[model samples]
Target: MRIKRPRIRQKIIFTLERQLVKGAHYQLLLLAALIGLISIVGGILVMPSGEPTSTFGESVWWAFLRLSDPGYLGDDQGNWRRFISTLITVAGYVVFLGSLVAVITTWMNRKIRHLEQGLTPVTANNHILILGWSNRTIHIAAEIFQSVGRIRRFLEKYDAKKLQLIILSEEVSSFQMQELKDHPMIGTRAHEIVLRTGLAIDREHLRRVDSLNASCVIVPSLAYGRKELISPDIETIKCLLSLNAEAQAQNNQDLPYVVAEIQDENKINAARRSYTGPLEVIGSNTIISRLMAQNIRHPGLSAVYNEILSQVDDNNLFSQVFPELTGQPMGRLKRAFTRAVVLGIVKSEGEHFSPQLNLPDDYLLEDDVLLVLLAKNSTDLVWRKDRISTDYAPMPFLGMLPVEELENRINILVLGWNEHVPALIRELCTYEDEKYFIRLVGLRPIAEREKELAFLSENGDRVVVENVVADFIRESEIRKLAAETFDHILMVSSDRMEEEEEADARTMVGYVLLEEVLEKASKRPSVLLELSDPSNESLIRRFQSEVIISPMVLSHLLAGIALQRELNSIYNELFTVGGAEIIFRNLPEYGLSSGKKRFDELESLASAHGETILGVYLDRPDASGNHLLLNPAKSHEIGLSDNDRFVVLTTFY
Candidate 1:
């Protein structure tokens, strides 16, 4: 049987009710229609006796004013006008004014709710998209802002209207928003940042931040939480997979470059496999371990690396293809730049590039080869063709001297323990020719550490590992340990604490106690500190110790890789064992003691010994408030002293 249709009147009433329930906009429209009907009826029904010249249009205007404002009700004269005005005012108060306020309030509440949810999709294109956030979020953002040359070039390359950094996380909290807003760069340029809330592993959520169209996407490792067993690398891989899935239908060239941080070295390969695009996977553990080992070998190397990686510093690594200097030998290229130090050349291999640093003197630059330089800015990398004079005579190649032997047997005291200690021990063991005695003091039991380091049992000839269970937070324990004679000390951030700030505080207190105790000792050991939070870096600056802020270093590395992917291999080579290393050699060792010499002559002399003279380390601080002056003018003259050292890049056998 067929159902009968509703009457037109019934249908109209149903439609009106449905429209009112739709939303604030529809409800407002219905109220306006009702008010218009009421005003028209009132306009035709009444006319004041005091104003007999009022036309129909004037009457309608009078009714509208009275319905809109209650003050017009008192202006009526005749009884008929007063009665009509009273009815209209009563209807306006209940239907027009009340409903209008309700609609506005509802609309405002909806908008606020929407904003809090962070569900709205961002419309920015060619922006940097950070997928997850932790204590490192602010550092990452600051690094990006500090990278002036890289950021400017990225915008120009993509033809982006402005520089924008959009962050997507699980939730958009007010505290997080305020923290970002308080940043100096973000505060002035508020439109340059956009924060949204969503799961990075979800394809639907990835679209909210327009990830596919972003210039670069950074996936930072997540900090461990209470009872959280999942590795951060797993989440990072999932994020990469989601991004890949989202971009599968799009052109390969349109996909954004991704830089992901994997805490485990084994998971790095898995992460790379998850994303089939331009990708740079950072192995945090290996990096931290290699740096720690390097720090133990070279006391002040941390400061040098910090200065070079920092965006606020004067000298930074830059690369540019100089077609004009094509065919010039690498040795002669030393004087090619007035403000930059030519480190090496970057040779492109189709889709990839390899950095050949400290190349042989006779090696000539080819077309499309980029000069790897260290300078204050890219603008300072000017090709000074005039500096390479035609009449300049080459310095005579000097005979190579025998390698100077370093301290063979060294004692290292470790104040704390974490996953990186084992890797650090292994890295130090890689220098097999030298013997290292490592003593570890931590809150964990000795057995646990031994089990973790059981694989190193057979390497007794290279490294001797000793573990002592002690509370690093206790001042007496630190004093007892600090009194012992040691060549170097490493203070790792405590992972026992639940919060990053707490871990940093514990580590800082230990460092302070160590310093206080060592102040009385006859010999002070080189102390290397690892801080979990970058904000605590200023707290220990007065100590002048080798401080490694893990988050800041990661952020800097990620930012650098985002700008130039080739820097990944270069950094790995510089940091790892069995590769080129930056070292400080005594002036006497280089056969220079008292005579004044030009910087280029020094470079030529170092090249004769298969080394590159980067700069000089003085006994006193330079004008820039640092002991090291990197990449000075090639023609700048300076006298060598017993205390002076030349910073050189040489292959560490």
Candidate 2:
């Protein structure tokens, strides 16, 4: 049977009707329109009964001109003058009232927008709270969402329908929230979000996020504070300190953790000295510089970042603390973390400030910090891919490297100038060994302007920088660099954005130059670009940039911290200290690798070899390794294959 269609008006009805109400000024506007129309009509009808006023139209016409002044009444206007005067009086009243309403409505709109900028508290507890507004905050929210949603399904195994997350900022908008709004994982109705803009140093505003109750607070890298005396760093430090002070006052038995970003190393040291709270700082300069250098040398750096950050499915990450590592050397566990491509390790004793600088101390395994990365399952990982069968292959998660193909030493190139470069170069030099070759392609006898480069290349001081005075923006200049064999190239735009457009232009030029290099090169390499603006991110992405770093987003997260100033400390713990990493692991195909398989057996095999298992993946790189289960149940089927890789976090590696 055919169903009857609803009436057009009924079908078009929306719940938004209750949300929006016509303002009083709008009513006044309608009245004003009516009055204005009447005044015009009345003025025309009030024309004088002149020689030509014998016709009804002639009299009205004569009166129309006389309304604005008595001059029209001089030429035998007669009693028509009285009608003209009356019409002007009515028009005056209508105009005055209309103008008054216009001003009032504008004022009302301003106030409404202001009020809408405030925040709403969520009833959900133990949820991750993201503060401020920027690109990183978007990623932070997504990461936490994926983290908790899985925790609920497998650990708490709660219904995914009720997951809760809160973001408080004045800058949150529908455009910025597109990714979250489109994600089906949120399991809720859509809401265009723009957080109430607030200074990070403002304590009262920080409370809007209820920092004390959040599971973790992520303070991102930097915020552009152009034309302002107070840099975002100073603002972030003050805000973090205030948050710590507030937490002490509340005496809350269960305040959440704080994760922050530190732009400068010295500031990071100072921050660590002050706050004793649970905090971390992600070194913006160190990471950006290193990544930039990598991208500058090899274009694949962007591809690596894409793999590192991707979170779709069976590509999620897991972190684990290695117990057996206490007595074992990290070299032994490298196989474990490396079989799955372990990213970094958290230090055991004190927090780490720069991941780019620190190597595992002999005590890396003994450290209290946890190691993190992506994995196929909580159980120990298995490498397969050698065998094939008629039935579905097992353990396909690991993107196993082909045995015949040799892993080439990574190439790195750095361009542009920034204070962070010296530290970045220092850290990068430490990583070079048998597997990596690093060359500095720049000018020699560096000019006074190249002092920053001189400082960063301190370790490589004797190895003078190649002084090539090529404008990085010119495609031909970039092509010459691309001619040399390299794996990646990093473009850094440290120029000031004070001109309002300078930063963007500089960044665009940098991005264009990098793209041009890759484009003109007979062989394509990886590309990583950096900028200070999150607003221009889309434009940069248009260049097909693989890795782009923005300090602005990091600054937004930095504002979320309370008084203790623990934000940087947390970043130190996770990123710098190897507290968290992204790794790739392989799964077996011939064997039955389901959750039904005993985890301890696989764990025993990995442990017999000193592996620390965290999570599993199903070999889908772009899907975010979502297919692999983390800390799976004893009976959950392990859906993996040799083609698939897993992410593992181990204290040893």
What are the candidates' C-alpha RMSDs?
Answer: 5.3, 16.1
lDDT for each candidate structure: 0.80, 0.48
Whole-structure CA lDDT of model 1: 0.80
lDDT of 2 at 156: 41
* Per-model TM-score on C-alpha atoms: 0.86, 0.52
* Deviating ranges (above 4 Å) for candidate 2: 1-111, 119-128, 148-194, 213-215, 223-229, 248-255, 288-305, 312-314, 319-412, 417-420, 432-458, 461-463, 467-469, 479-488, 493-653
Q: Write the per-residue lDDT of candidate 1 for residues 326-382, one digit (tens) a residue.
A: 888776787667678777877777657777887767778999887888888767878
Error of 2 at 322 (Å): 13
Residue 511 lDDT (model 2): 63
Candidate 1 TM-score, C-alpha based: 0.86
Native-to-model Cα distance after best TM-score fit, residue 445 in candidate 1, in Å: 4.8
lDDT of 2 by residue, 340-443 (tens): 43334444444432331112322245554445444543343332232111332222233222211114555556555444556666555543331434444333
